[model samples]
Target: MSIKLDQVVKVFGTQRVLDDVSLTIAEGEFFVVLGPSGCGKSTLLRLISGLEPLDGGRILINGREVAASGLHLAPEQRGVGVVFQSYALWPHMTVAGNVAFPLETAGRSRSEVTRRTEECLATVELTRFADRKPADLSGGQRQRVALARCLAQGASTILMDEPLANLDPHLRGAMEEELSAFHKASAATTLFITHDQREAMALADRIAILWDGRLLQADAPEVIYRRPRNRHVAGFIGQGSIVTVRVTAAEAGTAHVRLGKAGQDVACVADTQPGTAALLLRPEDIEACGDEGAQLCGRVERSVYRGGFHEADVAVEGLDAPLMVRLAGRPAAGERIGLRLRSGWLLPA
Candidate 1:
């Protein structure tokens, strides 16, 4: 199913939860909406699932209008299934019973429900655990059960509101793989909501960054990470530092910028002009090098061991913010180091 939200709006008393948000999710696409808590991520999912009525704008499913101009369809009529963070399964029901509940409630024949339940269980690889109850399953297994129930509902579009938020770190990693495989087998148009950037980056075909009730940026995972549209997205999506730089010249998607006292050429948008602008420097953009070939020099203010690497913050003379660098070994505080700028993105004015 394809989802299109045109100027979608929601409000609670004096607060506007979602302000003029608009985006189209392609059919069978795994689209993720990423934002911090209380940023209307859950409200967006609720509106799409028909749990909440829209205060403004329109929602379309497969080119059919579902919510608009006071015309709100019920959840059952929308043909979309929602899996929430709590994994709201009935403790008394077995896995097969839970998967078959929706079909049976819809007045389907017993044989039909039985066959469909079996098929859904097989798809999630939970056929062996058919008789197990929700309380008897592991966190990951319970999540899969929730997914199997969604599939059993015959929903073309699946809405997941941080379904993996309750899992342990190791289980969350394993469940990500399971969810990917489940999406492939089911071929559902998935609209996932999460505050976890790692989860969003791992599973999404495209990611939309929502902040303060506004849609800040939406693009492929890597594009949003490398070339964020603004300061908010640059800081929210990944670890990096935004520093003011003077763009001396720009041509062919490259910006020759002066970072403090050192000059370097970095990646920029086509329309970037020569002027003062903000530049985003990720850890990978700065490199430790020999003093002879160094483009810049700084003293390490702090370093933290990150398993295989040491992330050091280097303080240069003229720059206000410390430049983050990844080193193979930890360097002592106040130690002078030679650095080179390999690449960076110039934020648009």
Candidate 2:
């Protein structure tokens, strides 16, 4: 099912939790809402799911108005199944019982509940543990049970609010795979919310980032990473350094920019307006090259080992702040090195 929000606004006391938010989730698409903590990521989910009242704007599910002005549909009527951050499983019930509970509550016959429960359990690969209590299951298994319940509900639209937050790192990765597979198999319009950038990148068909109750951006993962709209989006989506650059020239499909007072020039693959602008460079975008071969030269100020790579902070000659560069080999603290941004996006100043 397709879902749309038009100029949605939510406020609490004097705080505006969401402001003039509008978006559309296409049928059978996996969309993710991503942001840092307290950025109103969860609030947007609640608004869409009919769990919260909106101060203004409209919500449409399958082109039917669900929330607008004084009209608000009940959560159950929205035909949206929500898997909360807590999973919200019944503590005293077995996995099968929990999965079947929603169906039974909806007036489905006992036979239908049993059949749907079994089908959902199989979908999540939790059939063998159908009769087992949630407490007896591992964190991942418990998460699967929650997912299974959503499946049992037969809702074509699913809203997931950090359902894997309680799991450890390893389990989170495994669940991410399972959730993605489920999304594909079911072909549901899924809107997942999370604060984790990696989780958004890993699971989303497209990601929408929220900040201070404002929607900063919404785009395909690669586009958001490589061509962020502004400094805020560029800085938040990845580990990147924002450097000021003077746009010296612009063409039909690219721009030539100069960095620092020395006029170190580089070509950005964007049709940017010519003036002062910002350049976003991820750690991997900067290469450690020979001193004479690279566009910018710097001294290695710090190098810290991090698994397969070293996060080196370099003191560049013309820049005031240390430019972070990721390298496989660590350079000495005082070693002079050459640096060049292999690629970056230029944002209007």
Candidate topping TM-score: 1
The superposed Cα distance between candidate 1 and the true structure at residue 87, in angstroms, equals: 1.1
Go through the candidates in order and give the C-alpha RMSD of each one to the true structure: 0.7, 1.5
Q: What digit string (tens of lDDT, one per residue) describes model 2 on residues 1-349?
A: 9999899999999999999999998999999999989999999999989899999999999999999999999998998999997888999999999999989998999889999899989988998998899999998898888888888887889999998888999889899999998888788899999999999999999999899999888999998998888877888887867877778887765677776544544546545777877777788778988867788888888889989999988887656567889888877998888787776667645
State the weakest 10-residue window (summed lDDT) of model 1.
315-324
TM-score of 1: 0.99
Q: TM-scores of the models, in the given order?
A: 0.99, 0.96
Give per-candidate clash totals. 0, 0
How many residue pairs of model 2 clash at the backbone? 0
Error of 1 at 133 (Å): 0.9
